[model samples]
Target: MARASTHPRSCGLKHRGFGRRFALLLMPLLVVGCAWGSSSETRTGDRAVPDPDASENVTFYPTYGYLEDDEWVVPVRYWVWEDRGLVSRVVTRVASSMAGLEPQQVETFRHRLRPFSGDSEWRQRVTFVFEDDPLGQEYQVLDERGRAPRTDRNGVVEGKVRIPAQRAEELLAAQGSQGGWLRWEAVSRDHSGTGQAILVPSEGTSVISDIDDTIRITEIPAGWSVAVRNTFFDEFREAPGMPELYQEWDGEGDVLFHYVSGTPWQMYESLSEFLFHEETGYPEGTMHFRTVRKNLVSISTWRDLRSLVSAGAETADRKYEVIAGMMEDFPDRTFRLVGDTGEGDPEIYRSLARRFPGQVEEIVIRDITDDRTLRPERLEGMTVIPAETIERATGPDAIVADLRWQPQSVRVLW
Candidate 1:
């Protein structure tokens, strides 16, 4: 993924249209605002142990590493924040329900400002992002191998360490390929954190899958309110047979996974936990989530949230850029594109298939919309599997091109 703006307070979008549509929706909730400020930081602390008394905490983002020249470049990203408790007991009540209206283009916009999302889980999630003060803290890797990196204005630290390819291979080999964490010591706080790292080799089979309706059911087709309720209020429900199916592919031990989603980074912890849960059984792949910066303490934060609903924020471009970057980075590796018909996955994947032929081996689109008459041209070089019947596949892996599942002039009946 491309690096975000270097400036800390740089709110990326300044579109006027962002606020007009969602003005009434979040106006009442925006009536109440909070204040937050970061204190001067200090780096004096013991590196060996974590202190429960430490005021600041570090949250590591799970990511992947790549091989460049003779070294392995692994990204060490983290969020530094003070764990303030819930900001307020104020419930996020919907101003009005969107029962029949067509859902907006982006899921994040539709996922915002829910009325029934007053539960502790939803509140805590919001508080973590909006309430906490993200300090521009500094830290060094525990091994003292690379330069110590500091968190940006958003309290996020994006840095990398370069290890000799041979040594990196040794560590990865011992850590079980994707089963590894990098230890770090805080220079300013009396605490430490571990960042999960998945190492994708120079060339291999990688599965690029979508989240939302593709894996986790977000009910995008049910309209705006339901999608938001499902996101903020209800427990995430996994798509039928996907977790089991992904687990089967992950068991192969040679495949790499990349979960590309339009969901905001705020839902990362909850979504990641669900994916790694004992029942879910999905492979821990590199995550590609869109970032939407928000500060609940200000009325202006609503404008940032509104970007999710704005026309400019349609995720087709974001998904394309992310997936295309991956294909470019690993030119020799083959990729399998997986998504749902709930949105624009078919068209996006079709574009990728055309742009990078042979590199993308298969395109499997889960049919969330029950369109009996399929347009073969739209889904050219793809398999349209009904979302429900995808589980009936007692055979073939996710990328295994089955002749029976090939797309026809009408549709592929799985």
Candidate 2:
């Protein structure tokens, strides 16, 4: 547990002299869609119980903190917003499995960052941004008990910060556990929005689709053929059975939906619309883009000198930058990445899985036109389901059965 003596004097004080500085240090850790609750010993949000019965309105409990000896700081807070409920399902699952275990046994959580249930609309979304902290190079979340949440998530509960089973039960009873997540539940998908819907599933299956040609046809080079592939599109279009597939799998239960694309911010508007369009829309998941700029110099400048950078310059490295940014924007939920064989989608997804293996449940790769030659050998030890499309992949029970196999790494890690 976190020792009260080590907590900064600004822990409970709002907007005091150190409040802005404290908030600045902690803000980077405050992302959307994380499960949370107060520990019986400590009233921190990280100990919240599960919400197995999630509705359209999901509440997220964000855990934020920095170390006592280290410069790392985080301002974790809860945000109730609209989410596609993609990683939300995954986190809920992992959270459920780890419910009774000690905090030391818990692993990392993941999710993409986008608009929470608020002013952001279908056409354009208000992205949650993060500012840099000079006090430290590493970021960490500290529980109220003053202990860091476990990262390895192995079944040996020890030095980590967690709520006891009895405490979790008490909190769940008080908060109405939905989807197995305690303080934070998912927002209902039925709420009026611009995003499309598949036939609502009795148990929602999160759609982790690619954003490029999977929806919008963006022009890009593909070997000897024209670089322009149908998946990396500019305008959102309905791919063959994608809409129906998303709807069929759509539901209010344990579904974690996401769209992990390789498109840079240059196509942010187009990509955003493609994910939330009316004709071929699905619920909005975290939209990953390229880095704001390449190289450490660009990164430093963007983090410290955002106002000076041009929009194009920011969009240049948006892909890589967005990956890191999402960690802070949505800390509660981990991701199940879905992308295409085109471009650098595989590479990016692989890197993410590698950096936070526990957070990524699986990688679903849609093979466009039998281009196995272009595919990677593996995706960071996780199962990579290579399919032609929605039907080809989920067509029969064969593919689904294959997907049921335990990932060698996750099984070992778990």
Candidate 3:
């Protein structure tokens, strides 16, 4: 494990307690222009555009949950498009800049926009039918009445579906020792969706990873300008060999991945797409995201950049809470906590180690900041690897060896 430097630099804006407090106090005033319709109009006329429907706009985000009693209580969510055309894009771009979106704030904006002053197809009820060979041999249609409220009024539907333990067990048996993901398909009246669910073995390693900075580059600790450039305008970049490293850890079977990040649920699609293209080899598991309230005010008009800088300050706490919950949920499973030095991952993981003890197998903190001083004292299972080291071909193997994780013989069935 990498050791923390004895002489660390000041921990940046996130470490300053006063900055966050002041931002909270000014939140109300700063968020006043968050409404979708409040932005200056760019169109020539007040003409209505055809709204997108389920067939063209619906998207499903893959997520997982622990098995409770006799079922796998998985969290399933899908987004229906109200509009994905130029008009909505223009509104979003203008609104985001006006709000001066912080990385976290940008996610909130992506996940929570509503029809401020437009013809809304937002909350139209839609029943989703789920089918999985392992869960059952038939399609199970979820009742519309039982579905939970949309995560966002701008067409995001949230709900949970359970797969029977018997079916899950059968699927595992079919995989024959090298447990693989159980595939599932979903469909609405006018759209279709798909995802995979992992039946975590009773005894194995589960890697809990942080997405931004840790794997995907967002330059979170960097101020609002860098955040905006990376998140909104720039292309998504992976942290060197992270994808291969994760794949190496995921070798064969006996390893599961759960991404717990401060990134809002709105970026689910974007992240999913990135993972798909990057071929990170991380299997779809449960993704825990920050709970961002809809900011009624615009993000662009803050009095100073300090307010925007502090927007995601609460993420450290949120990440801690989610990781703690994962520990409680899977008490028997060992974990490898992966994160970066940009935020409070080291402290958070240390606290988790103290709280859960032996359950944590290791802690791998990517040294994105490159300031070794920011690293904490060497703990029993913590290692800080510099980002530069990860860029090499040998980097992935070195990481695996350092973690002392034995690779299993994985069979690719698909």
lDDT of each: 0.54, 0.34, 0.55
TM-score of each: 0.67, 0.35, 0.66
Scanning candidate 2 in windows of ten residues, the lowest lDDT window is 394-403
> lDDT: which is higher, 1 or 2?
1
User: What does candidate 3's lDDT look like per residue over 110-185, in tens digits?
Assistant: 4333322122235544444334333345433243565446435435556666768876667657545244556555
What shift in Å separates residue 257 of candidate 2 from its native position after superposition? 3.9
| Candidate 1 lDDT trough over 10 residues, lowest sum | 121-130
In candidate 3, what residue range of length 10 has the lowest lDDT sum? Answer: 396-405
lDDT of 1 by residue, 253-293 (tens): 77888899877665677788778787677787778776554
Alpha-carbon shift of residue 14 in model 2 (angstroms): 61
- Candidate 2's residue-wise lDDT over 199-250, tens digit each? 1112223345566545443222222111111221111245445555556555
Report model 3's TM-score to 2 decimal places.
Answer: 0.66
Candidate 1 residues lying further than 4 Å off, grouped into runs, are 1-54, 86-88, 91-149, 173-188, 295-303, 310-314, 372-376, 388-414
